[model samples]
Target: MVLRDPLRGLARRRARWLAVTAVGLAGFVVFVVAVAVYRLTAADPVFDRGDISGLIVVFAVSLGFAGLGGLRLRVLARRIRDTASENGFGGWLPAPSAADDDRRIDFGAETGRLRRTTRRAAALVLVWVALFTGGLAGMSLLDEAAGELLATGDRVPGVVLSVYDPGKGTPSMRVRFGSRTAKIVRDSGHHYHVGEAVTVVVDPADPEHVRTTEEQNENQFVFGLCLVALLLGLAGAPVAAGAALGWRRRARAVGVTGWRVATVDVVPDRSIGGRKRPPPTIHVRYRDGTGIVLRAVLSTHGAKALADFTDRLAWVGGWGREMAVLFPQGPRRPGPYAVPAAAKTPRAASAFRRSRR
Candidate 1:
């Protein structure tokens, strides 16, 4: 299966699919390992008998599995390389050998515009749902962790030495912790008289910092949960938002049959993280028969591959969709990024292909 200029879009689509699959598989592996570790160790002390030897055995087993997986991957790659000239990944995608010649190719009538749109839209929706759900759960966990860390992780013991009334309904107490004494107002619900013992967690490094614990046993995983949840929530929020915006755009967009590249711009990296990333964004300008201009921010490889840009079908939208609702700056603002657009397009006759049985 060789992909020529007409099929470069397929390459881009497959690349994205492969990247996402790799990430999903890696995440599943990590989650399974984490669950197994928690199940195995949550019931026992960190340094129980035979724990060190057990961990060593587990490490060895894991290493062996990884080696085997790597070997299998290599074998698969070798097979792909050898048989690539005859078949393309068992007829799914175009092999490198197919693109070596200058022969014009067609994917058939079944792989039509409507089918492509449906497939891309469904994938985008699934991604959006997963990201939004994960982010929401992470935020809730983060809040709970913060509360637990405040209440239990920093407490010290204190004794109420004296109680006094200042003419108000609320009473005050002088609490003593070690050699330090501090005046504190009693909470309206707390029935504290004089000479009462209370557990107050205080920062050892900071004497002024104090907190009282109401919950018993305390949550030991608060700090770890907080860090993990914070990271997940922060990372997933933007991805979820972007996916949702893309989903909405596709839902409300007026489909343009084909788009031609008007220009390509390689701009300087201006983003915060761009200081270390030397690769600038590849911004491609596209226009349809209506003279309406749309743009796509692509990777350098995608841009380079689409430089010919003839007969390429792309999906783009203007100010009419939910872009105004999602973006505070409004949809009238000019920006470079078109949804559902790809680097490849089909000729008018080949746009519709026969269904593969």
Candidate 2:
């Protein structure tokens, strides 16, 4: 299907977006695999568990799904626009395919926009990296604190050791670190010598490094969580960048019909009324400058597909309904990107169609 000019050509641009998404997916895969390997090999109980594997799997799936979904969208948008072109007169937009073949869509601005997301994502990843570093550093600090407590060997004056509550409870000095406090308990038969200072025998090299210490090994998971967060954050950078760029391009090409902005908000099932299959969704709402609101329910495919194809619609006047064809196999070109604003004034016949449809 072919439209007059601009409307017929959006499919080509969508192809470009698919390419960008592909690169992002590849990057994400590499990142996840790298992290998984690191953890699997570390032989750290914290890293080698099934939970870590689950996280890795989730991360990989998100990347793969996003990439494949993007590819599909581009394809569908291309198809929709191409087919719509041959059908009939489009409202505000000129058939984009009618544009000169050599005039590529202005992707430079789009590319820059996408890069901004990378910067933001990269900064977040950097923060995670810092957190991971801090965790390692903290282990050493913990060892120092424990060692200090242990140093007053046997008995030190004015010192008290804490122990689990007994039938006739022994007094325990509270060990507080910031907000978290742990009550040290006498390991069975051990009792504090009178006036003996209670010290934790912690290795100086590692705060977590302890010998004859009474702390649980469960704490190592904290470092593991930090490590996972770091990996996920870093892995997401490229995908974020690609998505941002794609949106920026759409905004520049086709401003939404009667709406200034759009967003794809995903919430947990519990948050949205326990939706079993992506519920209370597939909706489009429009608000006039005043308080009037216009909305309609959309198909699930419509919801996902529309998010990326904002640029490829022919707007109806007054009512401002934009025609977007929904499809599961995307990369469907819904249209030549919304007609350029400069060329958007509808002809008499299109105006008539707008009034009627």
Candidate 3:
């Protein structure tokens, strides 16, 4: 199975991935807000070039972590399947909680369900990204439009009729702006004639330009929210992509491939992981009696991770057990591992047992 299944299964799971995703998203929002607020209150740059990668990395890590939970489930399923057939259970693995009962699970079904869940999660994530991008684009457009209109003054030649009531002491005027017009009434007792055609100055540099000195409801908050969304998305996108790549690398190291390949460890492989790195080894084992051996340079971390992961698989257990010989240090086969007919005896017998009548 691939990442899609596991990601989809994450959504279906009662695990912590959903909480992690939510927390990551919230953190993104908070970061964006903090930056915005800082810019609003201070004279510093809202964003720095050095911080872009960091922001992206954060989002990617968040996504990777969320996806990893599902991947772990898949790994667990694979392990269970491995233990079942390789460790004596006849093609059936016992459930974790149902170990007491005679209950067993079909690996294929478990794998399929996990796959579907992962696919669903991936789909949901894509949807979120699309929505976020779309929202950012829309906000950017609006911000640009507001700036442009303010720059153009947005004023067309028009007249206004002012009305004043002396008894109740009320004043109002019809104001015109660009192609549209509106009536501005003031609470202050400023009165004028009904046929007053006054010079209305709509400031070109200000979107809030109005001829009347009436109070206007400014929407700085709307811009702030949109800006927050934009920043969060901008920062999160690259990070998510990076995390995806990292995840793929990790998956590759775990013996997941279209063409099955095993590592044949002739020498003792010094398993290396975080902290002090260990030398990597290559182990290739085949189901047939025929087995080939080769030495692998474990310099790269990915390669080492793969070796370690493959080592944990039950299928490669027996091969790893028989490391009485060491593979040569070259591209050539490590040894002339000529399997005797007796070595094929058990495999043949097992195949025959499973063969259809």
Sequence-dependent TM-score of model 1 = 0.31
**Worst 10-residue stretch by lDDT in candidate 2?**
285-294
Report the alpha-carbon TM-score of model 2 versus the true structure.
0.31
Q: Model 3 lDDT vs. the true structure?
A: 0.38
TM-score against native, each model: 0.31, 0.31, 0.30
Report the Cα lDDT for residue 315, model 2. 24
The clash numbers for all candidates, in the given order, read: 16, 49, 25
Assess candidate 1 and give its lDDT.
0.39
lDDT of 1 by residue, 84-118 (tens): 32332212122123222222212222123323544
By summed lDDT, which 10 consecutive residues of candidate 3 come out lowest? 336-345
Candidate 2 per-residue C-alpha lDDT over 1-357 given as tens digits, one digit per residue, 9 for 90 to 100 = 212433434545555666666665666656655665454333232654887787777677767766776877657664544454454433333333322122333333333433353355456545655654554455444444445655643321223334345566443334433233344434324554434443444444554433234432223445456446546554544444543343333342332222122111211123346543322221221121111111222322223323323222222111112322112123356322221112222222223223222
Each prediction's Cα lDDT score?
0.39, 0.38, 0.38
RMSD to truth, every model:
16.5, 13.8, 20.2
Question: How much is the lDDT of residue 18 in candidate 1?
Answer: 43
- Model 2: residues with Cα > 4 Å off, grouped in runs: 1-68, 84-160, 163-201, 204-245, 248-357
For model 3, the superposed segments whose C-alpha errors exceed 4 Å read 1-25, 33-110, 154-174, 177-180, 183-357
